[model samples]
Target: MATLIVTLSRLNARRHATAPVAQGSQCRTETIPMPASGDLVANGEEIVELLADADCWVAIGADPDSSLATDGTGTARKLKADVPYTFGIQDGEKVAVEAA
Candidate 1:
């Protein structure tokens, strides 16, 4: 199976903060497993039913003081950020699935 490196970035950072993927994104020295896409649909056709804003569950909880909050919680305390995931598809099926 293929592999992917998912990363996150704090959009509310006062200074320039991003991940390596684009900018301040994070890239581990090792390859990690693919995370749950939060996609519970059995098929793509049913995606039409999950049009609600909360239908797609993204991030939750908080960022904590060790996270971006180290600088200042201001807005980071609310776990505000962006999730940019990477993956591949072969023959219309999602490839590079990681083991649970």
Candidate 2:
């Protein structure tokens, strides 16, 4: 199976925070196996870091559907093996991934 290491870092503090925190003050990480489809929802202003173990396809903010092929077609982006990619995303966005 293909694998993706996803790290999410908050760009700001929670709205109910009693104290101020710097941007990127909080974070979380997860390792996801692909060929299965699912959604990763962000809860706050955040950025995502994706590191793949094998070449794969990722669809952010959209359903993967019948896509996710090795040829790198039909997905929002293609992830190369052993490489790290990062990007900013709005709160409540969903990201999806699968084997390419």
Candidate 3:
């Protein structure tokens, strides 16, 4: 199993009085264990950042399945160990992480 440090943030961007205004909410961070069954990391998040202790796979809005062979072959994206990766997610979308 691979462990991931996941952070979810919501960015509020708008035009206020003809001026561009951008604000970010407090980030929610979690240490998730990625099992063969995969782990759900984000739900309806505006952005997600992930750092894994081991190589893993992530699928936005879908399951990552159980292994690397199946991951990315579908909807999953691969994440290298000890590297930080960020993703922009659509509203109401879900993200799942699985061990590689």
Candidate 4:
């Protein structure tokens, strides 16, 4: 499992909420199960393809050991390792916009 940290402008039922930031945007450090990769990896191509047409733009780093931020929730946050994975999508776009 991979923990994907997401920061949004607001809270929506579509996206799960774990905590909130001062910006009023809800943040969540969720996870995804990509057994193929064997670890948490948010490679631009892979992620973009995985979240096709999603609105939010997430930039995943290659920490391999430590990409997981303290909470991994913000305008720009890296996801943690070893957590369930799930992406929120609505109308062919990522409504859970950590970007849009």
* Candidate of highest lDDT: 2
Per-residue CA lDDT of model 4 for 1-100, tens digit only, reads: 2222332232233544664222243332233333212232232211221331222234333322222235655333332333323442222223121322
Candidate RMSDs in order: 16.5, 5.9, 4.5, 13.8
Clashing pairs in 3: none
Tell me the TM-score of each prediction against the true structure: 0.19, 0.68, 0.65, 0.19
TM-score of 2: 0.68
How far out, in Å, is residue 67 in model 1?
30
- All candidates in order of TM-score, best leading: 2, 3, 1, 4
Mark the regions of model 3 whose C-alpha exceeds 4 Å error after superposition.
Answer: 12-25, 36-44, 62-73
Predicted structure 4, TM vs. truth: 0.19
What C-alpha root-mean-square deviation, in Å, does candidate 1 show against the real structure? Answer: 16.5
Better of 1 and 4 by lDDT: 4
lDDT of 2 by residue, 65-84 (tens): 43545675654687889999
Better of 2 and 3 by lDDT: 2
lDDT-better candidate, 1 vs 2: 2
What tens digits encode model 3's per-residue C-alpha lDDT throughout 1-100? 6688867776555555563222345677777788533233445557777788998877665434434554336766789999999777665555567777
For candidate 1, the clash count comes to: 5
lDDT accuracy of residue 67 in candidate 3 = 43
List the global CA lDDT of all models: 0.24, 0.68, 0.65, 0.29
Model 1 Cα lDDT, one tens digit per residue, 47-88: 111111111222222221112334543221121123333322
